[model samples]
Target: MSDKQLTELLSLINQRQDRLAFACKEIADWIDSQGDRPVAGKIRDSLKAVEADEVLVKKTLTSLTLERPLPRFR
Candidate 1:
């Protein structure tokens, strides 16, 4: 795929991830309110991984959009 396409794909993926993370946090809050602190903590811990992955995705998208493209090797 072309760089432009890759950038677009990454952007979409990032948006989806953001939405999922938001929804998960909401659920975690509800779980905590219900007194299931352990499950809520687990959900939050899982969210940390998602947050890290989001950083990497953002970095990749930035590189794709801001850096010059490498020459094709064909």
Candidate 2:
């Protein structure tokens, strides 16, 4: 692939990361707004885990795309 294509792909990845972060924040905020309910705490904990996983995935993707060169196969 060409450099232009790689740049475009990276841009898209960044946009997606932004959107995912926004959605996760919205969910967390909604959960917090819901007063001290029995399940609210559990749900908030689960969302936290999901957010952590997202960060890991995004880091991996950024490393794979920006830090390392892509291999060309015959």
Off by over 4 Å in 1: 67-74
Which pairs clash (backbone N, Cα, C closer than 3 Å) in model 2? none
User: Which model scores highest in lDDT?
Assistant: 1
lDDT of 2 by residue, 33-73 (tens): 87644455665666676677777767755665565566799
Clashing pairs in 1: none
Model 1's TM-score against the true structure: 0.85
- Candidate 1: global Cα-lDDT? 0.92
lDDT by residue (tens digit), candidate 1, 30-49: 99999999999999999999
lDDT of 2 at 23: 76
Please give the range of 10 consecutive residues that has the lowest summed lDDT in model 1. Answer: 51-60
Instruction: Tell me the deviation in Å of residue 73 in model 2.
Output: 23
TM-score of each: 0.85, 0.49
